[model samples]
Target: MADTAFEAQGESVEEVFRGATQALLESMANPVTVSGGWERAIERTDVDPSTLLFDWLSEVVYWKDAAGVVFREAPLTLTREGDVWLLRAGLIGAPVDQQTQELHADVKGVTKHRYELKQTGGSWKVIVVLDV
Candidate 1:
């Protein structure tokens, strides 16, 4: 098993979330090889950023585990409705083919251990740990 840890920071919540998705993609395989042959729509709402991040990443892991899909690009939009934050995302990737794409580590799921999401200064920063 392998453990992958990464930190992503951005000026906005959307950028930070996209960075996290990129980190997840990199952990699984080369992003360049992952073409968009399939699509998944992810919608999540949470009261806080940390929980939203965890749910968002867990959704990605769900696709990987259930459908063998690894996302290379995630174009998302975030909105705030009262006290809740809503995320609507379009995920792009193809089904993992062992012979065509080089496999790195199989990420089982996102771990709550060492997971952090915070706003420092004017930027949003997130740290994620993935269990492989």
Candidate 2:
């Protein structure tokens, strides 16, 4: 059985992702949010998973910047293999760039920005981001 503790923590993470996704989506309709999200991401350093999150979020922001499309909430999956955890999520918006874009980091490549989530033992984990 899945641990109740993970369920609680996962809910919090989901909320954050949902809010962030919504913020980006809202930006498509309202220019202020788009600019704000972009400005916030720009002000920070491109640090591994941190930057990965920004880039993932930025992709949505970029759409608003380029075209103006809002993405719906996507189901997230978490998986693990040995010591590596894999996170999978379907891209849920009509994005301008269907083509995979190389992240400005050690991330090998974007899996269509899709992810898979999984758990093992008593710990829940996923490939939140990659370092290629």
Candidate 3:
């Protein structure tokens, strides 16, 4: 199986999520060249933080393919309401430009293999594997 393992960490969940977003964006291209002219807002909910993150990253991949654009920025917030955790993000993107961007392998999807999210010592960390 062609896959890549990714790790991200931060002092808070929101910061950790942002790190994950950066890893995701970096996996596809050199983000410095993306420009981010297009914006797509996304909302995802799940019963737990780990699942919420899994679903959110999946949505990011969805937008990348569905909109024919590569993401340059992902600004988000994670909140809890009742029994569910909700995540909202503004995905800033730009169309795939070969001349101006440094492209990499196409990401197939996020995989459950060795997928993990953990918080310890007041800091949060996550590990995800992507099918590339």
lDDT by residue for model 1 over 78-107, one digit each (tens)?
Answer: 888999999999888889987777667788
* Best-fitting candidate, scored by lDDT: 3
The full ranking of all candidates by lDDT, starting with the best, is: 3, 1, 2
lDDT of each: 0.85, 0.36, 0.86
Please identify model 3 stretches exceeding 4 Å from their true place. Answer: none
Tens-place lDDT digits, model 3, residues 2-43: 777789999988888899988988888878888868998888
Q: Is candidate 2 or candidate 3 better by lDDT?
A: 3
Clashes of each: 0, 16, 0
lDDT of 2 by residue, 1-132 (tens): 111111111343344444444444432333222212121222222223323444555454444445433344434543345644334554444433333321121223223232434345554333332222
Q: Which runs of model 1 end up more than 4 angstroms from their true locations?
A: none
Candidate 3 C-alpha error for residue 108, in Å? 0.1
lDDT of 3 at 110: 88
